[model samples]
Target: MAALPRQQHPDLLVGLETADDAGVYRLTPEIALIQTVDFFTPIVNDPYLFGQIAAANALSDVYAMGGKPLTAMNILCVSLKMVAKETLQAILTGGMDKIHEAGALLVGGHSVEDPELKYGLSVTGIVHPDRVLANSGARMGDALILTKPLGTGILATASKGRLATPEMEAGMAEVMRTLNRIPEDILIAGHIHAATDITGFGFFGHALEMARGSQVTMTLFASRIPILAAAREFALMGLIPAGSFANRRFCERHLQTAPGIDPLILDLLSDAQTNGGLLLAAAPQAAQGIVTRFQEEGCPAAALVGEITAPGKGIIRVEA
Candidate 1:
């Protein structure tokens, strides 16, 4: 993508150049359109639950961009012979539930028969041109808050292999199904400097994007980072996913850490997540309030895990 020719249009406020979560294009003086699409194979066994997760994940980008989702088009890839008709219908129904929850209409969709089952949506949203938030606007001294705990990736891999307990599996599923709309709304009303949802890249990978985009450094307090309780055990038992290791490698060059941090903690920090929570960079005075609102709104694990530093080499400094 870096080598691709730049496509310049005056109304394009945010695009591929910044590694932003979504593309924002100005439609008028007061409105800008936010567009994004995402899909992946079923990570869980339940068709309905998988559908909800996929749809929520797709819609999260719009919220991360500080916009209100407007409409969505279903994207399904399934093999009729491999998947039951009822199962496919359940998946669609599950996706619709989340779309409706976001106050977005389901306009249309496309499907293709494939051996592996997959589902997601192409979501479109709108935001005021001046109010649009990009992942690149995190400023020095801003406090970073993560809306959910880490370890979804590790627990998910364990579940896929049938190594996870039913309780653990259910917990992870619920987390993935939860939407970021609440925190986005609260932070936007508070002091949102920049925002991004944690997804396949894991915590550090996404944070790296923010730090690099804003041309600043992010100092993370490892001890305060919330993590799924079972995830640590899974990591110790070697249940970490390939994506987690890949994310570590992807961001290691720019990651600086204090001495004596456990290796497993680092793994958790880079654990790739699914429909994960939003990472908000709020001003110092409003950071605590942002976390309070998240908890009051039902995100018990929300926390202030880090702070932004002056522009440097676009690095992340982890305090053990």
Candidate 2:
């Protein structure tokens, strides 16, 4: 995309340049529009639950950009012959449930017959022009907070291998279904310097993006990082997905691990995520307050996992 020449407009606040979660266009001095779209093949067995996860994942980009989702349009690709009519209806119904939960209207949708089943949404949201948050403004000494535990990628892989237990599958589903709406709204008005959702690229990958984009190094406390319950166990059992290994390789050259740090833990850190939570870089003075409020508002898993360091080689230090 960087090599491609595209016309630029002053009203376009964010486009492909920064690799931001969404496209932000300033409609007026007070209001900006956030647009993002995402869809993927079913990760869970139940079509309804799969729809819910896909919708949540799609809406997450808007939340990561500190925008209030106002509406969404469905994007579906299904194998009509292989899927029952009720299953398709259930999928749309599930997505509608989440759209409503986000207080967004389901305006319309598009569908196509395909060999594989898939679903998601194209979400449009609104945010104050002055409050638009990007993943590139993190500063030195800023504290990093992760609002959800990692491990969905590993658990999902385990499910395909028939290694994940029913409890574990349920847990992963619950995490994916939950939106980042709470933290996004709560911290957007706070001292947050930068933010990004931990999704396909994983925590380490996205954090690396933050650091590199801000021209700073980061030190993450391995012990302080939150992991999904049973995620480590699944990872230890070698249930990691192909994407996880790819993530590790993609970011390894830019990472520095302390001596004796467990390899398994590193693998979990690089584990690709689906519908993960927000990773916020907050000013030190406001970090604790924001975290306290997030937890008090029912986001108990939220934690201060790391901090930004002075500009350097964009290396991420993992300290045990």
Candidate 3:
């Protein structure tokens, strides 16, 4: 908050210190430009799917602000010696396909030689100034809804199992490889208020981000929070990813566990995600409608997990 030009600009909705998705620059009294960029190593072994997920993740920051992704430029870091040039081509092609799907054009790109392949996009998007959703817009009574299921971390770990089953791989791949576009669509359609995509931070870390950003306390029902079927097995198999530890370190201060809570279930809440979905804060009337909207869009797992309270200074509690 201290780093931004908030003193000079009044319309900067959210920036470096607020934990918001993108930095919004007001173009006019009624229009704003949203900008965000991201790139990460492939979360999965499939180069093409990795490209697609990377593009989606990068674009998600814009959508998290209820903005439309209008354009992007590819960002690549490739190892010319280790991986074949063809793999990089397929990777870029996959990213291009997703950008095209979102009606965003890739005008150009830059590449660098490295030891490993890294790909994503630098996305630019547009939104009406008044309609821009900031993480702080969440009200005390706003309902909390998660647009996707948790467990990508555990599942991905399970995928590395020596006896990894085809079914398990299929499940984890679909979750990690998919985009958060639908939740963005719903938010843009005015079905939600504040929105944020859950990615590397995992579900609880992101929840803490929103709670702290909004200066509100959030109470979530453990039973209602959705999880993948394979997460438990993965945890039992000790397949948790490294990011899980980071998430816990950063977010542990705000979380409050309930009695008899399964430790693995707790871990799932901290597991890192790839192309995760949006967590929306909306009014109750709009909350049910939002769930229905996701379901109609074929997202049955979408759930209203909790609600916000008066600003509790920071993340308040995470209980069953």
Candidate 4:
């Protein structure tokens, strides 16, 4: 995309320049549209669960931009000869359930027959023109909060290798299918400076983007970072995904780790996530409260993980 000619327009509030979660376009003086699309092959065994996770992941980009999803269209690729009709229906039904849960309509969609099975959504959302949050607005001294535990990639690897127990598989699925929506009142009260959802790019990979975009340095507290139960164990057992290694390599030049920092923890931090949580940069005074509210509202893993230290060229400093 960087090699292609870019399109320019006055109403294109957020576009290719910043690598933001979604594109925002002004529709009127008071409203802007948030649009994003995401799709992936099955990460979990259950087709219904995979559909739910895929839709949730796509819809999260809008929420990261402080917008509410209004409509969604499915994107599916599957082999009619290989996949059962009942399985296909279950996947569509699963996606629809999440769309309805988000108070969004599944108006239409397009599908094509393919050898590999894949599914996701194209979502459109709305936000007030002035209230749009971009990942580049994080201010120095802002408290960073991560809303979900990490390690989905490792868990998925374990499942594929037949090393994960049934209980572990269920737990991983629950994390992936959970939506990243924060209540309007909570967002308004927190005074968020910036936000982005953690997805294919591992936690540090996304954090580097935020740091670079905001022109600020992030000092992360490694001990405070949330990790899913068994993620560390699996990672230690060499269950890390290839994407994790790629993410770490991409960010290593700008990453600073304190002496004695646990390699295992670093592995977890670099784990590629699917349908992960929001990484919010909130006003220092309100950050703890935001975490509390998120926990009370069913995000049990939400916590204050770090803070913006100073203006810098997208450097991240990790302390144990």
* Best-performing candidate as measured by TM-score: 4
Candidate 2 per-residue lDDT, tens place, 189-275, comes to 658888899999988899988888888999999998889878898888888989889999999999999999998988999999999
What lDDT does each candidate get?
0.91, 0.89, 0.80, 0.92
lDDT of 4 by residue, 1-320 (tens): 77777889999999987889999999999999999999999998898998899999999999999999999999999999999999999899989998988889999999999999999999999988888889998999999999999999999999999999999999899889988998889766648989999988899989988999999999999999999888988998999999998998888889899999997887889889998889999999999989998898768999999999999989999998
lDDT of 1 at 226: 91
Give a tens-digit lDDT track for model 1, residues 162-231. 8899999999998899888855566347488899999999999999988988899999999999999999
Global Cα lDDT for candidate 3: 0.80
Q: In lDDT terms, how accurate is model 2?
A: 0.89
lDDT of 3 by residue, 1-320 (tens): 56655444687766677778888988888779999999988777778888888898898888788888999999999878888878888899989988988779998989999887789899999888878877766788889988778888777776666545777766767765555665555555674668898888899888887887777888887788878887877777778888897887777777777777776767888889886778889987788888877766646688998988667865646566
TM-score of 3: 0.91
Q: After superposition, how far is residue 164 of candidate 4 from its true place, in Å?
A: 0.6
Cα RMSD to the true fold for all candidates = 1.3, 1.4, 2.4, 1.0
Candidate 4 colliding pairs: none
Error of 2 at 178 (Å): 0.7
In TM-score terms, candidate 2 sits at: 0.96
lDDT of 3 at 114: 82
Residue 221 accuracy (lDDT) in model 1: 95
Model 3 residue 129 distance off true place after TM-score fit, in angstroms? 1.0
Best by lDDT: 4
| Cα misplacement distance, residue 179 of candidate 3 (Å) | 2.4
